[model samples]
Target: MALGGILEVVALFIPWVTFTLGSQTASVTFLDAFSKMTSGMDSFAAMYVRFLAFILIAGTLLSTLPWTLGALRTKRSAYWFSGIRRRELTPPNFWWYRTVFAGRATVMLLFHIAGIIAMFYEDLSKIGLGAYLLLLGGVLVIVGAAIGPKLTAAR
Candidate 1:
């Protein structure tokens, strides 16, 4: 999951699309393409893309940071909101944690798929490395989320 998050972040800076004219070629990174492409669009579509992008980034960071840190520190997956009340810090319920992670992964994956389809609807071949990386990263996150519970239980 952490690796997937890191990959997704890296992909933002990589070329997502390349345009070639008679003698000139220009490549656009994910960030550039997103901003430029959305600028000329209808308000509704632009808003939706922006919202999805926000969720993708937030979900990746939120899941990755805690999972990476928890694994490194205690070799266990971190539980969200695990003991905010009182002085003692109690571990969260395993089933609840797993459910949350799975649901979050599902949402993220769906958003990624939607974004990919929207961007490449006109020309599938125009899709580039960054887009592929984004898809792979989302898949990895889902795989990690699925296996996280079992790994935690085994430990």
Candidate 2:
């Protein structure tokens, strides 16, 4: 979870730094113009960078749900399995937690959906369907990961 957060923060800064540098060194050289518009700033560039940051942050957070849940299940069940029976027994417990993880994952999915919708509403012309698809796929995977537990529980 901490690693996920760190990665998100790092992703948020990438575009900001790239565009900031690009703007600042606008006249320095071809690369400079490509990197920045002014010595330290560019409103237009900053806006784009901010959008990119949001996408990165959302993507990271949205995907973290299932990753974190799986890690937790593995950690929780690691000690219970034996050499020979490990594979058979471990799967049951791991799957049992899916119901719990599903609820959590659903919340994360909703959050991602809202963010994606907001992005489209904010700038209809600029919104990319690719982003929405990516978010949707991430949500579906998380939700699916949690489905095993529910199915087992029903039985």
Candidate 3:
């Protein structure tokens, strides 16, 4: 989960869409994806893709926070957490928090649907590297969430 969250955040900076016009190629990320949706007067489906992208980012961050915070409390730098103790921060079992992860997975799935819509909706536009990274980030997050419980249990 932690890895997924980190990856997702990093992927935002990558190029998701590439537009080449008049010999100039511009690459865009999630940040630009939202604006792209607003440029045209009748791009409601594009809006859905833009919205889903934000939801994916939010869901991953929220779902991964507990794990990341717990790790922070234990990596020999509990002092860095100021007043929070390791035991107080780390949950013994992560699967108990399945609802949060489930929410993230749901959003990721929605994001996938939105991505498909965007692909067909903007068939002429060239997809960029960032879009691929975003897809990967979503997959990683889901995979990490699934394996997280086993990892904690193994520990």
Candidate 4:
């Protein structure tokens, strides 16, 4: 799950699509694609795309936070939070984490699926590594969240 979240974040900076025009080829990251694609569009369409991008970014970060916090709290040197006491930083149990992760993952997955569908409307661009990574990351988180509790309980 942690890996998935990290991958999703990393995917933003890598190429998501590649465009080939006869003899020339160009690859663009998520931000690059967003800027280039929206630059010439009408306000309504641009706004819609912006909204989806915002949701996708925000959802990925939000969903990843709990797992990160939980991981941090488990470390021996995790007392890096300036003034906050150590006890206050302790995370909830596996079930709580699993539930929160699953819920957020589901929402992120929906937006990601929507984004994938939106990509089909574009012309002459091949989906790139970053997009596939994003999809894989979302799936990993969802699957991890769903089965994590059972696996932990079995041990």
Off by over 4 Å in 4: 37-49, 67-100, 122-125, 147-155
What lDDT score goes with residue 36 in model 1? 69
Between candidates 1 and 2, the TM-score winner: 1
CA RMSD for every model? 5.2, 11.2, 7.0, 6.8
How does model 1 score by TM-score? 0.71
- Stretches off by above 4 angstroms in model 2 are 1-75, 78-96, 122-126, 149-155
Q: What's the best-to-worst order under TM-score?
A: 1, 4, 3, 2
Q: Which regions of candidate 1 are displaced past 4 Å?
A: 37-40, 43-45, 48-51, 64-96, 149-155
Clashing pairs in 2: 22-35, 22-36, 22-37, 23-36, 23-37, 23-38, 24-38, 24-39
In candidate 3, list every pair of residues with a backbone clash: 15-130, 16-130, 16-131
79-132 per-residue lDDT for model 4 (tens digits): 342122334333344455555557777887877766765665564246788878
Best by lDDT: 1
Expressed as tens digits, the lDDT of each residue in 1-155 for candidate 1 is: 77777677787888888998999999998778567664557643365455666667676667644543444233232323322122222244444544556567778778777777776788889988987887787777766765553334543
Please, what are the lDDT tens digits per residue for candidate 2 over residues 15-72? 2112226447311221233355344654443433335435545654554444444433
Task: Compute each candidate's TM-score over C-alphas.
Answer: 0.71, 0.37, 0.59, 0.62
The better candidate by TM-score, 1 or 3, is 1
The local lDDT score (0 to 100) that residue 36 gets in candidate 2 is 51
Instruction: Return the lDDT, model 3, position 120.
Output: 48
Using lDDT as the measure, name the better of candidate 2 and candidate 3: 3
What is candidate 3's TM-score against the reference? 0.59
